[model samples]
Target chain A: MWRDAALVAGKDLRVEGRAKVAVNQVAPYALVVLLLFGFAFDQDRPLLVQAAPGLFWMAVLFSGLLAVQRSFSIESADGAIDALRLSRLEPAGIFIGKVVAVAAQLVVLEALLAFGVVVLFQSRLGGAGLLVASTLVSTAGVAAAGVAYGALCVGLRARETLLPLLLSPVLAPVVLAATEAWRAALGLSRGDGWRWLGILACFAAIYLAGGAIGFGALIEET
Target chain B: MSSSSSLTRALGISALAAVAVNAWWGLSLSPPDKVQGQLVRILYVHPAVATMCYAGFGLCALGSICWLWPRTRSPRWDRLAVAGAEVGAVFCAATLITGSIWGKAAWGVWWTWDARLTLTAILFALSLGYLALRRAVDNPHSRALMSSAVALLMALTVVLDHYATAWFATLHQHTTLFKPSPSIHGWQLVTMCWSFVALGLVFAWMVVHRYRLEALEERYESEGYLVAIEARRAEGQPVSAAARPETGRVLVGSAASAERAEALVEDK
Candidate 1:
């Protein structure tokens, strides 16, 4: 099952490698969103520093969502999911593999957005250690939850609207904790951000377990 | 897994009664607070929704586990668990929205991504998405099974959301519902308790209703297929007798299409 899932995961990566769509499509959107966000803030340096993590994650989150939502849609659009199901690969493995792919996309988007925030807001980049950690932890969470959810709602009516509505509420905690952790890591406040990191860690665990159990059933449905 | 004929109807009536009872205590009977007064009245719907959301999340986890067991694939066990998930998600939405209203009244903010509040919102979104996934899918058995897993995964987010502050410096306040009262204590507590019973009844009713629909739809489709297959068999080939009216519908609920019925025929 693990090997099969790895193959599925690898296939996802290969597809993206060929198309270069995630970075090509989603990255520009994130950048434009960031530029617009900076423009709206009226050039307040201290204020922007305080809000930078939020703005960064906001873009990452929405962009991450766009990326995650498509993971299942791509397969389902062409009846690829039907073939995947018939292939006799374990559904849980498929779920995990897709999560890895989406997680990778999220990481790329976050890195690019982080760079943009650093340049546009002129925020301190001295806390590279924490910034990297925060982004990685949060991205893990986004990938896990997105795969499970992506599997479930991919076939629903009004899927586009439904995806965000359903995901935002559930994903909000990871967003809150990780973004705060990233902000704190960036030197937003001296107050400890370890608590947020712990929450992100916990979110990742829950998602992993959830994927194991939920992905099985979701595969049957898909 | 099947409810007796009268029992299903009785449960249905009981659910309606619960809604009425909760409405009275929550809306009219509970004494208005002397301090926060009517603003405190918001307490009625708030606790009900929050607890219901928790229960729904619990069911999501349970559904995931059950889906792994082949026996649960039967419409009987499968529909019951899925029903719990759908109702649970609905309550989760109630929890987030009502909590926000309460937050706005108490904190002067419409939305705060606090650890607990934000988590609750995420939970609601997850449940809604879970339901949407169910609708989007074309298969029946697979739909129930996959949703079971999605519910479980989504519920896992609750643990993170709950403990988010342990990792970050969250402005989101810790739970105040359980805090020892400084004033208006006992009476306020009583109102909350009463509201709980009322809401619990409603939750039970919601599950029963959704479950019935699931069963009926399951039965209607299966029976429809049985009818088709029986026709096939009557034409001199072998097929399952699920098409016969003697069994009625094995699962329940009304179906919009026979594709699902056809899917079951393929399985059998």
Candidate 2:
């Protein structure tokens, strides 16, 4: 299972690497979202700094949608989904691989957005340990759920619109917890960031297990 | 079928009577709350509607699980699943509306990030997604499987979401109605419990009707496909060409002819 997962992960990542869509498009779109937040907040320095954590995670959540869509869109093109099914890689492995690939892209996106938060919002970064832990767990939660849902909608004609509508509400808890954790890490809120990290971990575990167990059935029909 | 339809009619009548009595008892018969005064009346309707909302989703999850299990898989279970989800989504919307109104009256705000309110809103979205998925997938088997997967997912997320939101922020009052000692007594309690019975009957009636409608629709779809296939066969089309996999509509030669046939069928 681990070998299959790694192979699938490698294939997805290699596809993403060659395509450069995440880099050229999603990353800039995320940065632009941060800038737009600046505009929405009227460039209010204090408010922008205060809202940085939420704005940052919201950008990640949106970009994660694009990453998951791209991952499955690759499969749907040229009958690759049938090929993947026939390839005999375990469904759990495929699920984890998609999660890993999307999480990897999201990690990079988060790093870029973290920098944007600092530069654009003038937000100070403090708790490094909390920041890293929360990012890893929350990204896993978001990516696992996103990949599971992406596979569910892959065969639909209206997937482009349906994916976001279906996925965003499911990811609400992750966004809420991650934002709280980041706010604490950035010294913007007085809440315990570590406690929020624990919630993020719980969200990640439930989705990872749920996706792994259910992905096989989900994709069988799709 | 006659017995079940009779049962549904009986249920509908009982539900209407019970709701009427409960409304009168709650609005005018019961004394005003010492704390909330006249605004306390919202409790009778809001709590019952919210309970029905959860009950509907719980039924959906049960149907989904039964369908997912290989031993119990059936179109009946799928029908129940969709019926439960559709009815649940309606009650969920009502729950939000009633809860919002109560919140505005009591808390001076139309909405809040409280645990219960947020969770209901999320559940509402999940159900809408499930319905959208049902519409998007053309294959019946795929639709059942995919929507069942989504229903189970929503069940799992509801558990996680409950805890996540509870810890995030908890402004809603804890379970006051279902406590051991209970918070209210006498007429208010009677009225509230009666409201549950009333709304629960209504929920039952709606789900039974919806389930029946779904079963009939499935029959009609399969029968329509058969009729279309038979029509094509009479026209000397090959069986293989007449029976397309995704949609059963017969295709004659070019795309333009296909569209024309489709339009003719639509007109008829």
Candidate 3:
């Protein structure tokens, strides 16, 4: 299962590497969202600084949607999904691989957005341990849930519009926990950042296990 | 004949009677609270309706599980799942509106980030998404499979969301009615219990009717396919071209008789 996962993840990364859509489009879009948040705050430096953690994750969530859509769309075109089904690889492996690939893209996007938040919002970064831990755990949770939902909507007519409507509510907890954790890490609030990180880890674990177990049934539908 | 069965008729009548009696008792007989006064009246309907909302989703999750299981999979379970979700969505909306009203009266705001309110809002969105997915998929089996997966996912998220929000600061009251020592006694408690019965009956009635409606829809859809196939066969066109992949199983040997096709369509 692990070998199959590696193979699928490698294939997805290679396709993404050649396409360069994440690097070229999604990453820039994430930064653009950050800039827009700065504008919405009316260039109030302190307000933007305090709001940076939330704005950063909001940008990640939105861009993460695109990455997920891209991941599944690659399969929908040319009946690639059908081919994957016929390949006899385990569905759980495919699910994890997709999660890994989407998380990889999100981590890079988060790095860029982190830089954008600091430079644009004029905020200082602290609590690096909490910051990095929350980022990875939150990304994993979001990716697992996103890939699972993407698989559900793939090959359907209204998938493009339907995916966000279905996915955003589920990811609300991740956004909430991640924002709180980042707020604490960035010293914007006086709460335990580690507690929020624990909650994020729980969210990630639940979705990861649920997604793997349920992915076979989901993709089998198409 | 109407779609309702005797069971539904009985349930509907009981629900109406219970609700009427509960309303009179709650609004008139039940004395005002020492703390909340008239504002406590919202309590009778709000908690009962909210309970039904969760019950409906619980039923939806149960039906989805039955459908997802290989041995128990059936269109009946899928219909139950959709019915539960549709009814649950209605109750969920009611829960939010009534909760908002209670918030305004008690908290001096139309809404707040209270844990219970946030959880219900998320659950409402989840149910809406489930219904939307149902509408998007054209194939019944695929719709069942996809929506069932989503239903289970929603169930999981609701549990996690409950805890996640509970850990946050909350303005909503904790369980007052269900606690060890009851907060209220006499008429308030009686009215509240009756409200549950009334709303529970209403929920059952709606779900039964909704389930029947879904069954009729499936029949209508299959019958429509047959009529189309029959039309194509009469026109010397290949009937296979008109047959949908999902309805293909019903087409074999069943579409052979024109009289049966005409009768089915006419019955609708």
The model with the greater TM-score, 1 or 2, is: 2
A28-107 in candidate 2: lDDT tens per residue?
99999999999999978998888899999999988999999999999999999999889999999999998999999999
Candidate 1 scores a chain A TM-score of 0.95
Greater-lDDT candidate between 2 and 3? 3
What ranking emerges by lDDT with the best candidate at the front? Answer: 3, 2, 1
Rate residue B13 of model 3 by lDDT: 97
Question: Which structure is stronger by DockQ: 1 or 3?
Answer: 3
DockQ of all candidates, in order?
A: 0.54, 0.79, 0.82
Specify the CAPRI tier of model 1.
medium
What C-alpha lDDT values do all the predictions have?
A: 0.73, 0.86, 0.88
By lDDT, the best candidate is 3
Residue-wise C-alpha lDDT for candidate 2, range B170-220, written one tens digit per residue: 777666577689898888888888889989999999999999998988888
TM-score of chain A, every prediction, order shown: 0.95, 0.99, 0.99
Candidate 1 residue lDDT tens string, A102-157? 98888878878878988999887756776677778888888888777777677666
User: How high is each candidate's TM-score?
Assistant: 0.74, 0.91, 0.91
Q: Report how far off residue A115 is in candidate 2 (Å).
A: 1.1
Interface RMSD of 2: 0.7
Q: Which scores better on TM-score, 1 or 3?
A: 3
Chain B TM, per prediction: 0.71, 0.84, 0.85
